[model samples]
Target chain A: MSDLSVLYDAPGPKAKRNATIGSVVVGLALLAVLYVVYARLDEKGQWSWDLWGPLLDPSNEVFELVWQNLGTGLRNTLTGALVAITLSLLLGVVFGVARVMLGRWARIPVVGLIEILRGLPVIVMMFMAYQLLPALGVNYEPLPGPDAFWYMVVGLTLYNLAVFAEILRSGVNSLPKGQREAGLVIGLTPLQTMVMIQLPQAFRTMLPAIISQMVVVLKDTSLIMFLGQYPELLYQAKIIYQDLGNTLQTLVVVGIIFIAINFALSQLAVWVEKRMSRRSAGKSIDPIMATTAAPVKV
Target chain B: MNVIIDNFDLFFQGFLKTLGIGLICMVGSLILGTIIAAFRVSPVAPLRAVGTLYVNLIRNCPLTVVLFLIAFGLPTIGINQSYYFFGCSALIIYTASFVCEALRSGINAIPAGQAEAARAIGLGFTQNLRHVILPQAFRTAIPPTGSVIIAMFKNSAVLGVFGVSGDLLGNAIILTGSRGFDPVPVYLGIGFFFLMITIPAGLVLGYLERKAVILR
Candidate 1:
């Protein structure tokens, strides 16, 4: 009853009757649609144990093949995401700081770079790196994994760099002007203040967003499968389905894996966010007392 | 440039298909999202649960996985359709979660008193939502909704991943492979069309948001 105000009041006797009828109608309509979709799927033999049994059986040979391929694909996908995250986070921080702190001439170029990189589709950037770069004599033969890995990493880095820069810049910009002024008042240089005072707090403020971006990085790794043949989870799933002739079963397994990993990741981020907010709230006790020079009579 | 000129018809077809898919998905997701948002804010328990479960499931899953499921899995279910149709369906399904979340936030921004007042005036659930709540809520929702649409449009590039060759990305790939053209310009050409659609849409949406009437 207390939460009822959040949306609407509790229905009166007359209104309750109407609501019940309305909800029943809505429920029936939804159920009818679901039944139709389910019937169609069932007709296609999608529910057959023959198509799905091998995937479920622990002792089956097909499971062994799938498990091995899953390892390789998972490793490659992680490698791409890890390398891209490391490069992008570092470069993003640098670019973000420069955009805010650098002179007008320097800031303009950074702005232009961020804009162009952000505007282009990630796949197009990947294509450029994989297909266009080798043509331009920019070979990465020494790089680990296939050419596509480097291309995907570089592509992800370019796109994410722009995104992370914006995130960090806004995080920093949102801080109080007094924080910077206090640094200057204490005889610290602007650079010192930014590094020692501003950045630490900005990192804390930006951690949740950065973690969410990591989820994006993981998802973008799947896009690399489209550019060229790479041993990512999606590509492996494609191969398995074609070989086993159980397209639906293979894809369902792969989709479950992706959802599990990503869902866990996002949940962890939410947990950390809650914990951090609690810690920050505890630390910021007595804001007025901390800010005042002298105590006033109660 | 020569490749584009020679394959103008192919590019034009690709443009039309991309536009068609984009428009269809946008409308579909918006309508579905509004319904889901209503469910989330509804007083009934089952309706709220359904909305919550859907948004949680769809938002966490990758678009590629969803598309793959639709493209490959639908055939097994005897619902075989063109890749384009399945691709459009996937985009609609995935994008609707984001749109629902956006609209839910908009709904949440309205003061509790607004809803209470409407109920006091004897307005029913649907009437309150349509006449009082949504018009005000949409003013705050415009920015996030625009972003969801833009992201959805960018994501439609992946329709080619399903071998739907009637999109900008698929056409670019085919043009490069068949015509031996440089990929840079081909991609640039494709990117131009996307930016043309999205950037203008963003600017107009921003203007609309600024001009939107705030009821509360």
Candidate 2:
């Protein structure tokens, strides 16, 4: 038997009988629980088609009423995620390479910022960006729009910047020592070695993690709705619910949209991983294995 | 700082509520995660399918959406409760998938021989898991589990968005609005409280990880 199958014995006739009985019992229990839950929902009129009507028909007036708002919300969400992800990747590369070049003592400030930002909640940071920065007389305007949107972008960038730094640092360190040594032997400065030889390879090696963190940035845009009028998908859904009183239906649709986008991104990460391993003929270390050795920062 | 001291009761209550939600979700997610992990590795095909489906769906969805669903969806299904209840429920649901994945990784770390040895001694599946596999698996699982716990703690702050009162973030917002004080100092205090919770937990988990490595 393989590792996963070791505890699972090959079933003798009696063991097969027991296994069948156990399956039946478990199946019945599941059915019973589902039935109870369904009955409760039905009794509360939750199964009525009226609540789901607007969503089922694209031609409904309700859809028309909310369509513009939904578009705006979707646009803002994408903008926030894209901007933050791009900025963080840039920041991450710089700091990650710095952390590697500068020893522990020299990198104290960088390391401290990463640790603190990683520890702080993204929502709290957004709050600080939205209210505190303005109070402190900082321009607080990264983008020329609503303060909430910029706050979200800034907040998300900071947290993700730190996380990607650690990921990239580990990614760089995981590379063969000879890669750096070879660059130095060619008369390259440390910065040149990193810029020319190491950072590019580290990024390729860490693509799965970087992509997964992009998915995180996308999801975090939802938190901006908490800040007020920051019309992301979640905010749009909330607004629709406030207008239509179909809270469950609105949330379900919004959830489906999020799940679809995130699922697609996750699948892309996996596909890239498979393609990379195949191209390398399994020579490159499994990127997932490397990144997952640490607690996933997202 | 003056704002923090002057409204100490508000901050304390919020702190307690935040901790309460964190504790509740921690325990709830652990139990749910164990069940899901068990389902995932079960011999029954249907059970495994269910477990896989649950994780695939939940892990991809944002916690905000999940929280919104629970906060509003459950009311339609006749289980109306406070925003606090919905917040805790959402945290448990969202975090359980990560916890299950972590535990599954731990379970995978076990050598096949240990499971085989247990079965050779006539131990059944549950017995083998409890007596032979899980204890060893958990030693390796501690770090990821700690990360999930810390994540859940940070996520508890999202409860404020749904108008849940008495959470650290929520009260900070409330008090800032009510007292008409500069939000920077209030938020600074709030951030410190979160760092206090997360930093120690990180250190402890780091220690445990080093200790586990030594034992290995």
Candidate 3:
């Protein structure tokens, strides 16, 4: 019984004991490095303490600048994400269904759209949008604070819709034939069966992948910084760093904040995916947070 | 048609520039990425840590900032490189993170028994890895790294402003945006040019994935 326990764990009791000691030694080493870093900051005492210590100081101008920008940035980020999420899902439905139901005359265009858009680098898409839209006479310039906002949203949607089409197509394809046949046996139209039976179950299987793709979308909004037009949270951090000549510290804060946002989004994705997968598999609702970076099927 | 016919030389020139920059960035990144990937997967813990921190910092932070810092900011402190090297350096570091991760995933998929068997032959770590492990790992790594390469090719566009002069989209911007021609067709044309590269890469990757079916 004891041997069984030892076999299952990577670092069994003996290895664990050794690793523990090793971890302590490494931890102390890390502390020594931090101490050196702090001591170096003391040498450059003017910038270091002011910059690094701003997180605690509620009244620091840097914190206030971040706080103000953060609020507006969050609102703008959410707005961009909202528009993207909405537009992508709509296009996903259109193209995804086309992939399933339409012939080549219809499907080729959709397929081309997916290929071009998905092939696009996210940053280039934004850059292209910024340049392309103004030249296209899509210049509804009557609206407010830089039409690049709308362009960014549209670009994100274009890329996402292309990828989401993959998720949707796969989901719909994975539905067993019997469900469609059963609907036909009940004298329902093929379209009705698709709407009633197939799409629902397809969505259930695809929910996780779709949600994960939203993280792809969320992280992408950071790409808007390329335009140098949008004062996003990322841009805001860049500003402070550029202003204060404290690039590393500002970036640390920026990275931590981005990670927190991505983490939260990932948690939500995991939650939805778990429910959908569990229900599809007809298992007891385990609600496991499957963070396994498992191999995607080729 | 006349628009292109008149400037066919310039267009071809731009196309060649785009391809050249893409190829240069691709080769540079793959070499740098492979070195970092090998370092990351090395047995030496400190080497792995060093490589991982490099990847994390480069990957999570924006590439644009790195390019700007290197391109514009460096001159202020008296470090000077041509914009070409700066662009290539940024692209190499940034895309290397993704390439390293993709390769690492492929390397990880290699069964533990392979390593054990290599050890069983009394081979040292480097020799065992070289002789027995890496060839198999390369096979596994091919599909994902292929896609990463394709993605990296697409991403090389980001380096356009850092001195890929006569490149497709950047040149289009400099040309049309200055001349007041509609930039839409220029970008659309550029996007199509990219598709010519990316689509074939995707197909090759798909074919390789099918061939390398560990699980099918």
> What is the CA-based DockQ of model 2?
0.57
Clash list (residue pairs), candidate 3: none
TM-score of chain A of each: 0.84, 0.87, 0.80
TM-scores for candidates 1 onward, in order: 0.87, 0.91, 0.77
Query: CA shift at B67, candidate 1, in angstroms?
Result: 1.0
Writing each residue's lDDT as its tens digit, candidate 2 over B1-216 gives 788899888887888888888889999999999899889888876688789888878887889989888877787667889887888889899989978877887887677888989999999988998998888888867767777788788888888767788789988888778768778789988888888877777887788777775253
Model 3: per-residue Cα lDDT at residue A55: 47
User: Model 2: C-alpha RMSD to truth?
Assistant: 3.1
Candidate 2 Cα lDDT to native: 0.79
- Alpha carbon lDDT of residue B19, candidate 2? 84
CA lDDT, every model vs. true structure: 0.75, 0.79, 0.66
Residues B2-31 of candidate 1: C-alpha lDDT, one tens digit per residue: 767877787778878877888999999999
State which candidate, 2 or 3, has the greater TM-score.
2
lDDT of 3 at A133: 66
lDDT of 3: 0.66
